[model samples]
Target: MKKYLFYVLSFFTLFVYAQDRQLSLAADVWPPFTDIDGEKSILSDLVQEALGRMKINSTIETMEFAKIFIEINSGRFDGSPALWISDEREKYYFFSKPYFYNQLILVGKKGSDVSAASFDELSGKKIGVINNYAYGDFDKNQEVEVVSDLSNQKNLENLLSDKIDYMLVDALLIQYMLTYQLNDVTEFLAIGKKPLLVKSSHLALGKHVQNAKIILEHFDEKIKEMIADESYNRILELNWIKADVDGDGKMELVLGGNKAGTSAPQNIYGLMHDNSYKEKNPPQRYYVDGKLYETWDNIPNNYKLDLVVDSTPSIEDTYIRLDFLD
Candidate 1:
């Protein structure tokens, strides 16, 4: 009897430890957001502080962006930080609520007549873009000459030397290059605020991680709390970037006064249905956990889940109600 009791207690202890396990995070150096300054990046510091508030400990590792995705998909690491959550990635990983927004812009040398008011205007032009860059709608066109391998500094330099006409790059990357790489070159201009695309950066969890659904739920709650308490805005301000609380291209607090809930999930979905929201890849539902549970039931009893309603109904308008056997 004593031996049996010992075994039972040991099993329970192991289970508890597994439930309390820490998560491993992967990322690359993208300044102001994330930069390698010895042990942590600016974004990592904010994430660490946010996780700490929830009493969750995370171990962060910096590596090449490509390798980070590979490791995440292979289940080698828990997930990558600051990556755009897409439908393709949703198949293998669970994503947290978006904490920030980003845009892809076109940059060219000054005095160039490459007027690209729209994506169609760039047809037949030699476009230099990073290899493996998945630009939702932009990648659909077949006429544009795409010069891959422009992710590296030397490759970008080559492109600048007339190797390619224009490059579709991330705004943050352009900022970094301006501050670090092209400090001497004052002739470049990021013409026309024509946002090629906009996406929210999220923290993702691998499919193989146990209790991924629960973990993601916790993360979502934490993110909401952060946003509501102004921690999210404060972090972006501290990092010297505009705060996008609503995940829209415009950098205004759409959550305050008349703008409150303007871009709420329901309203956003309605805009999508009415063709007002022109996202090439629409939002999708991804089941991170091996099993699916009602969204309401997944949330703790102490917390309230906000549900937004639009003129047109969508999955986003519904509340999740978990049904578990007692």
Candidate 2:
């Protein structure tokens, strides 16, 4: 009887250890977002912090971008910290709330004519862009000649070499590279004032992983908590200060830091900042009720009913339930 009890106890202990094994996350050498050798990046840090909050241990496996996708989809690694949602990807993975915004803009040589008021105007122009990247509506425009490259570095290099007229690149990526890696290259390029496209990035988990849904929920909850506690701001080194900047009594989110001299607060969130408000400043961040929105036009009709101030429905009505976080 004593021998049988010892065997049972040992088996249970081994089972628990196996079940609590650290999860593996696949990533690539995407700078600012991820750096394999350095084991640092905004997304990587955010993921680690969220997991740590949940007391979950994990390891990041650096691999090629293509292989990262393939392996994660096959359940070789648990999931990826950064991924855009698509019909194909949704089939094999569960996505969490957006952790980063991918705002894309155009870059060209100094003194070059990079003016293209619309996509149609870009016809017959050679525009360099990252391959397999979704540039929102720009992807549908077949008129412009898009030169695809493997990475942002390659696309930027092509731009500098005059291989392409203008390169469509992520704002954050260019900002990081210019600030850290390629400061000397700044004098050669001109960045567009207006953004060309914007997309939100999410944490993608393999559908086959055990308790994937629960894990996703917990991760998302931790992200919200991080944002509320201003821990997220510290990670990014940006002060997303929340206060009534417009003196409307309701709180507004302003993006700035104490290091830089403060500028006029931009009312980017809520319906008050919408086009219907008739204010000069346009909406920066869009959201409605309980759900955060990528664009004003994408907000649901049900929410629009209560948001219409003059009984006129406009696509620019933005109002996120700030109380929801409380």
Model number with the top TM-score? 2
Tens-digit lDDT string for candidate 1 (62-86): 7767788898877779886667776
Error of 1 at 264 (Å): 23
Clashes of 1: 4
- Evaluate all candidate structures by whole-model CA lDDT and list the values in order: 0.53, 0.61
lDDT of 2 by residue, 224-262 (tens): 666655576567544443323334444345333222122
Q: How well does candidate 2 score on lDDT at residue 57?
A: 81
Task: Show the colliding residue pairs in model 1.
Answer: 295-320, 296-320, 296-321, 297-322
State how far residue 222 of model 2 sits from its true place (Å).
1.0
Q: Which 10 residues in a row give candidate 1 its minimum summed lDDT?
A: 317-326
The C-alpha local distance difference test score for the whole of candidate 2 amounts to: 0.61
